[model samples]
Target chain A: MRPSDIAFRLYLVALFTFVFLPILTSMVFSLNSDRFPTVPLGEFTTHWYKTAFSRPEVWTAFGNSLIVAVCAAALSTALGFVTAYTDFRYGFRFKPAYLALALLPPTIPLVIMGLAMLAWLGRLGISGTLSGIVVAHTVMGAPFAMAICRLRLSQMDPALEAAAWNLGASQWRAMRAVVIPFCLPALISAYCLTAAVSFDEFIVAWFVSGLNKTVPVMILEILQGNVDPQINAIGTVVFLTSMALVIVAQLLILRKTNA
Target chain B: MTDTDPLVRFSGVRKTYGTFEAVKHLDLDIGRGEFVAIMGPSGCGKTTTLRMLAGLEEPTAGEITIDGKRMNEVSAHDRDTPLVWQSLALFPFLNVKENVEFGLKMRGVSKPDRHGRAMLWLERLGLKGFETRRIDQLSGGQRQRVALARSLVTEPRMLLLDEPLSALDAHLVIRMQGVLTRLQKELGITFVYVTHSQSEAFAMADRVVIMGHGEIAQIGKPQEIFRAPKNRFVAEFVGRNNILPGKTPGQEIVVAADRMQVSASDPGEGALPAEFLSEEFAGTGIICYFEGPEGVELKAQVTEDQLENLAPEPGQRFWLTWAPGAAHVMAGT
Candidate 1:
């Protein structure tokens, strides 16, 4: 290879290493039998993984996280699809304002959002519950879903829907048959991404999930008490699962767009 | 529909979007089973008029009637008028068969019947073997045929085409034009085709509607409109006509360059001073370019026989003349 090509490849390797080094380190340390994470290798064992899997608290928190993530993902995706479709297909007053508001959640700090939601949910008498956590995660994750779905909707030709309407389909039927199908891949990708975000989310869950601790909040609590190798194993599992979800979503989007 | 009743009628129809009037005081009558083409430059409201007929756009004033029924408030889906979009707009996710069956499916047709009808159209449009192929897998012409089949399967009262063949290659355009004409005749359906190409409009339409500045400049048979344009805009837009300053009885006149006969006699007050610039041999004839009075560039279509007889060269000063009756006189010209 040319010198420039070698330099470029090296640069890319450095970038990847920089980004993935922490996750790689964590994965390696999860397999180590050492009490504290260190560079020098200790005896390798699956004891921490077994401990993590066997714990009832861990299983409960994992179950709670799954429920919140799934619910949040579905709600956010549906809300995003509605907002994106309406904003794109119709003309209304203060449209920019509406879009800006829809996109505001992702821009604000998660801590601020969590605190605000805690106060809001307290007034509604749903604070410190699974439903409150789901609501909080939906609010946090929806902007990402909306952003992706909006992009897909914007790229779509409005004439497709028009053709459907011209072909004797009512406006609702046209959207159901043509527009929704066209945006399905993006919607799926958005759902997967929001689910991943909700799975890994900590601050909002910490504020709103009072009795029911999500996996991230549980991990934070465990870390605060002691630097257990079990925490490393659980973190590795959560990180890998979130990464897998995001990759699957990305692949689906790419396949649909043929990009 | 009877011969006396117009299938579609636009009476003083006006459409305004905010401050801009897209179509103004338009009156048109489209007969049953007639193929009418609306032609104009961009922003001349030809597409808007077609959309209004299809109930995609509501008229700001006046009335639009289909078979004597008012269509002012009817939605596009309820109106029995389908449009073949310029972009074709085939659903990319659906295969060819599904795309063609979509209209029928929307109307709640059973699966077996929808499949049979879609297959028939696919075969008729020469897309038989490509049934299960995705829209992205088809060629431009094939996709166009699918779009046509998708619209026609429902058997709407009228089919509106908005520059449907604009994206195809020139050769494909000609082939599709013939295909569209054949389909229209076979189906015997009223067609409202909107295009900017004069040749496409003239070739397929029974009558042509020429629009300018959001109003109809002229509406007549293609031959009539070509031979006798009502105004300067129609004359310039419809065909290659060299408009030049001239005079006729009781009206201000301009002579078409091709009709300007060169004569040795004094051509009178109607004649204008002009100098020959260039001549182009266009296979069957020659197009002679000239610089007229006040630097007006003019064109003249000279036959091969005329070119041989006259043998006019560049820089030739001549009295361009024509019979007064042959001159097309425009009002307020």
Candidate 2:
């Protein structure tokens, strides 16, 4: 190879090592025979993986994360689909403001929104519950869903729905028949993205989840106390699962955009 | 004028957007089964009139009646008139058969019957084997056929087309003209077509309504509108013409321009011609220009064969005459 090509390859290798070295280290340490995460290299073992799975607290946290993710994804995607459709079809005054509001959550600082949600939910007697966490995740996740759905809705053939209406389809029927089918891929991508965001979210979940511990919050708690290698084992699992979810979401979005 | 009862009437129909009147004080009567074409420049209310007739738009002041029944209050779905939009408006997701059967399904027809009718329409439109084909898989012409099948399957009382062939290529537009004219005659359904092309209107319509500046400029058969226009706008809009000013006597509109030719049979007592200035040979005919004493040029289309007999050259003197009744009077700014 040429000298430049060799340099470029070395640069790529350095980049990957910088990003993934800690993750690899964590995985290897999680399989250590010893209890301490970083004392010394020991014989390879799977005890931490087993210990992490046997813990009831871990399972409860995982269950709470799953519930919040599912509820947030469902609510955000549903509301996004409706809002995008309305924005596209019947434009009104302050449309720009509504669109800006929908996009604000993703750009703003998460801690501020999390604290605001906590205060608002406390006033409404809805804080310190699984429902509150779900609400917080949904609020944060909606901007992503709305933006994706709006992009898809704007690209759809407006004449198709008009054709349906002219052919005797009622307004709702036209939406169901023509608009929904065309927008299905966008809807799926938005759902996947919202689900991933809700599942992996930490800061907002920490504020809103109160007594209900999510997987991320539980992981943080474990990391603060001891150098248990089980944290590494569970972190590896989350890292892999999140990687898979993100890859799936990207594939869905790419397929939808190409289609 | 032939029938006393107007099959479809627009009684003082008008459409206004804020201060701009898209259509103004329009009154027209279309006979049953008559193919009428509305022609105008863009934004001239021809399309607006057709949309009003189809109930896609409501008039600002007047009422529209179809077959003697008031239609101003009816929704487009209940109006029994289908408008073929300028964009073909075929559902991209639905296959040919489903798109055709959409109207039937919405009207709650039985599955078997709706399929049967849809198939019949597809076959009639020469798309028999393409029932399962997606819209994107079809050619431009084929898509137009599918659009027509979908509209006709509803069995509308009158079909309204808004520049339906404007998107097609030149050859396809000509082909569609034949298809549309034949289909209209074969089905014997009333058709209200809107177009900006006078050639298409002349080729298909039994009567052509020419509009300008949101008002009816003239309404007549294509031949009448072509041979004798009601006003300058209609004359300029319908076909190629060379307009000349003339004074009307009791029985004659005297042409005193030098760019005209008159037969000896037109007596000098009623007709006058100044001098022929120039001549242009236009294949089958010649257009001769005349400059009058009033300093305005006049023109006449004379056959090349007729010119050979007269042996007329530039600056040839002749008289031009037309009977008083031949010219239709009109007013415009």
RMSD in angstroms, all models? 2.4, 5.8
Per-residue alpha-carbon lDDT of model 1 for B1-333, expressed as tens digits? 577799999999999999898998799999999999999999999999998998889899989999999999999988888789989888888999998998888889999999999999999999999999988888899999999998898887789999999999999999999999999999999999999998899989999999988899999999887777887888888655756544455554545556767643456886666788888876546878778888977777778887787677688876666676667666543
Model 1 per-residue lDDT at B295: 92
Worst window of 10 by summed lDDT in candidate 1 chain A:
A250-259
**Which residue pairs collide, candidate 2?**
B258-B275, B258-B290, B259-B289, B259-B290, B262-B319
lDDT of candidate 1 at residue A184, scale 0 to 100:
89
Q: Which stretches of candidate 2 lie over 4 Å from their true place?
A: A1-49, A236-253, A256-259, B1-7, B248-333
What TM-score would you give candidate 2 relative to the actual structure? 0.81
lDDT for each residue of candidate 1 in A158-195, tens digit (9 for 90 to 100): 88888888888898898899888888888999999999
**Cα lDDT listed for each candidate:** 0.87, 0.81
